[model samples]
Structures are given as structure tokens and as C-alpha cells.
Target: MILYIKYMVSLRCKILVKDELIKLGLHYVIVDLGTVEILENITQQQHDELKKSLLKSGLELLDDKKSILIEKIKAVIIEMVHYAEELPVTNYSNYISDKLGYDYTYLSNTFSEVKGVNIQQFIILHKIEKVKELLLYDDLNLTEIAYKLHYSSVSHLSNQFKKITGLSPSYFKKIKMKRSGNLENT
Candidate 1:
């Protein structure tokens, strides 16, 4: 049996889902972001209990097909942007469509209607957020970060980063350092 979970985005969320499943005495084959596969079919009592338990922790057991797809889209994007070792070599549309096994136009239309932003904009937003994280880490130069996230060039990355954050990457990193310095003195 496969179950979809809403708001299950992080590693911590995965752990919590696993813990809940164990407590319910349910055996699961997989507990990934936004989805789980179980060996045994869940009884209504067990399902209700699991749903209530997850809700207490700010998660939800989802049943709506469209909502499930939307959450799947979010999970894929989060995994790609934050957890994956490298971004996809292909374009975002193809990557997403291939991952979900759906037509890109349908997925794009649904996402735009529900999220009020086009898929490309959504990808750019996530990419910019990743750039901010890399900048804060100080492990990679701007050029390296650009390449890692598959940006055309450092200039393109900088422009998008500035447009989203209203600050240059250097200025953002400087702010973090300045804040850390002030905290150390206090």
C-alpha cells in the first residue's frame, strides 16, 4: 500500500514518519519525502490513528490526487535543489516531467494555477535559494556555485540572486559574517 504525506519535506520529517509507522506497528518498505510504501494494507483504525498522530506533528496524510501530485512536485524540487549532489544536466521541464512521468504542459498548468507561479519561476526561486545557502557555506566561489546549480554563467546566477534577494551574493555573505562577529563580541 502506498500513502502520500503532506508537508513531509525534510530528513527530520522522514524520521518522524518512520517513528509514527513503527508506533502504529505498521511495516513500511519506504519512507521518503511525501510518500511511503507499506507491506501490509492499513486498516481504517490504523490509518486514522496515523493521520491524527502525524497531524499533531504538523504533517498530514493526503488522499486527494491533485494535492498528492502537487506535493510530489514540491518533494522533487526540494530534493533536486537541496539534497541532490548535483542538479540535472537537462532542462527543468524535461527533468520534472521525466521524474513524475507526466506531460510537462499539464503539470505546468496545474502548478501555475495552484501556486500562482510558473514552473520556471519556481525553479529559479529554488535555485536562488540554493545559491544563498552555498554562499553562506563559504565552501564554493560564485563561479563554482553557478556551475554546481547549472547556471549559464556567474553573471546569470548573480542577476537572479540579486533579483530575488535584493542583495548581491557577496553582500549577503558579508552580512552573515558581520552578524557572527557582532555576536562574538557580545
Candidate 2:
């Protein structure tokens, strides 16, 4: 049986879920982001126990088809933005469509309806967060960040950063550095 889970976006979450499954004596064939495939069908009692255990860790077992699809969409996007070694050369829509085996229009409409934002907007938000993380690391220049994140140009990245953060990238970095310095002194 394939189980869809919400908030299973990180490696830590996978470990937690795997541990819980082991404790419950459930044999899982695979545990990937937002999904778990079991070797055998679980009884309702086992399912309820697992659900309760997972709830304590802030993960949710999705029962509805729509919710499962939505979580799958989110998992794919999260993986692409945060964990992918390199961005795909094709358009993101095509990549997502091929990955999920759903029509792009259908996926976009479903995502917008469930999330109150388009998939493109979600990608941009994740990209901005990634940019902020990279800046905090102080490891790369704006041009490098833009190229790594697949932004067209540094100016494009700067404009979007300013629009979303209400601060220029340099100002944001300075603020973060000041905060870090304060923490070190105290």
C-alpha cells in the first residue's frame, strides 16, 4: 500500500517516519518524500496507531485523493528547489508534468485552488528562501546565486528579492551579519 504523508519534506522527516514504522513492526518497501510504500496492507488498528505516533511529530497521513495529490505536487517542487543537484533544462511545467504524470493545466489549477497560490509563485518563494540561505552562508556572489538558481540575471534576482523582502540583497546580508555578530558577542 502507498501512503501519502504531509510535512514529510526533509530527510529528518523520512528518518522519523522510518523509525515509527519500525517501532510499529510495519514493513515498508520505500520511504520517499511525502510517500511510503508498505510490503503488506495494514489493519485499521495499525493505521490508527501509526497516525497517532506520526501526529506527535507534526506529520499528517493524508486520506483524501485531492490532499494526496496536492502533497505530491509540493514534494516534487520542494525536492526540485531545495535538493536537486542541478535545475532541469526544460520548462518546470513540463518537468513537473512528466514527473507526476498529470497534465500541467490540471496540476496548476489544483495547486492554485488548494494552496491559494500558483505553482510558479510557490517556486519563486522557495527560490527566494534558497537565496537567503545562500546569502547567510556568505559563500556566493549575487551573480553566482542568480545563475545557480537559474534566474536570468543578477538584476532579475535583485528585483524579485527587493519586491518580496522589502530590502536589497546587500542590505539583507548586512542585517544578517549584524545579527550574527550580536549573537557572537553575547
Candidate number achieving the greatest TM-score relative to the actual structure: 2
lDDT of 2 by residue, 18-121 (tens): 99999999999999988999998999999999999999999998898989998888888889988897878798999999999999999999999999999999
Task: Name the regions of candidate 1 deviating beyond 4 angstroms.
Answer: none
Pairs of colliding residues, candidate 2? none
Q: Residue by residue across 54-88, what tens digits does model 1's lDDT show?
A: 99999999988888888888888988898899898
CA lDDT scores, all candidates in order: 0.90, 0.92
Q: What local lDDT does model 2 show for residue 44? A: 99
TM-score of 2: 0.95
**Candidate 1 worst ten-residue window by lDDT:** 6-15
